[model samples]
Target: GNATMGSGVDKHALERSSYEVLTGAADIRDAITKAEQAGYDLLPANADLTAAEVELLQMPQRERRLREALNSINGRYDYILIDCPPSLNMLTLNALVAAQSVIIPMQCEYYALEGLTALVSTIEDVRDNLNPFLKIEGLLRTMYDPRNRLAGDVTAQLSKHFGDKLYRTVIPRNIRLAEAPSHGQPALVYDKASRGAKAYLALAGEMLRREEMASAGA
Candidate 1:
């Protein structure tokens, strides 16, 4: 959707075999078919398991559906990534309930901190009210400008506050990244040699490392 929103990410740039699980689709089957043609396996939403079902784990049918979906993917895929929309909507609540962890994507600008307090509060509230097992996946600093003093200062502050939760790989601002989505492609496929692509790759590796640590701990 962000790609379609014209943030420069091309929808077609995703890997040929990657799956698209559209929870927001008006017609689940149609969405799945389209994604299937594009080489993605779309997920269907059952009426009983909608995002509006906030107490999903407590609802017998909803819980069963969620467990089935999660269990079904146990060995089918190496990962089951949930792309959540930016909002405190019912959908976001469902995502929080479903995910064991959350990754916060942020820029290092001074203004970035403005909403972090509220976000952190929301996370804490969610942990208390809904999912106690949830944890922060990581804090990724994206679209960074190392030369900017404000960016440098904010990075230091965030690092101090988040400690090891901050990722080592910082995603720098790149024109190529801004341009990639227009062609419906990821920066990696659009410009593999570009700095943006390299940064995202590094980020992927970092994420994998963090996940491995989490798994080992579990």
Candidate 2:
């Protein structure tokens, strides 16, 4: 319906809160503290940070702002996730430096494959010069529709290239998943019976199973 949901967050609030913390007007802290869970933790995108990028350019070890902010709150969470803005910007470098592993979510399309090549190259550069701990953990195929032949072709190509690094679970394109965000909720909370919700649940299970296997193998 695209109607306004009463409980949705204000963009200005996120902008204000983020600017205060990021610029040290308030406290320097992990971006996680800025989130409001809509079923999963999400540090809402702060547009003000785009300006911070320029401010960072003149500073020493500028790429380490996010990494340093997060370090103070270490061991608070088993996993810390950052969704990067597209492009190899200063902010993206900060996340790569802070992360232990990278998960690349790709759409089953030729353009997305091309993007992966660029992302892989960037990851390699970060590993070589910035963050040695960073490595590809998984490549998740998103917005998948089996009816599309192009999708199948791209999936096959990804399998051939990535092999074991690609996750088996695919996130299918479903209306419920799309609709959930407008209502300020996760698909599972908005429509637990929906295919999108079920697929996510399956993905969660696969993630846990793989984590256990990795620990055993390690």
Give the candidate number with the greatest lDDT.
2
Q: Candidate 2: where are CA atoms >4 Å away?
A: 1-9, 14-18, 28-42
Tens-digit lDDT track for model 2 on 1-218? 01112124445455334445445554444433322434344344445667877887877787877787777778866776676777788878888998999988888888898899999999999999989999999899889999999998998898898898888999999998888877776566788899888988998799889899999999
lDDT to native, each model: 0.64, 0.74
- Candidate 1 residue lDDT tens string, 1-218: 45222333234443221122222213323332233222334343233333344544445544233333455456655555566656765556656776778888888866678767777888888789777988887888998988889888998898899999999999999999898766655566678899998998899998888778879999
Residue pairs whose backbone atoms clash in candidate 1: 8-181, 9-181, 10-181, 10-184, 10-185, 11-184, 12-184, 13-184, 13-185
Q: In model 1, how large is the Cα lDDT of residue 94?
A: 58
The true-versus-predicted C-alpha distance at residue 157 of model 2, in Å, is 1.4
Going through the candidates in the order shown, the clash numbers are 9, 0
Question: For candidate 2, what is the lDDT?
Answer: 0.74
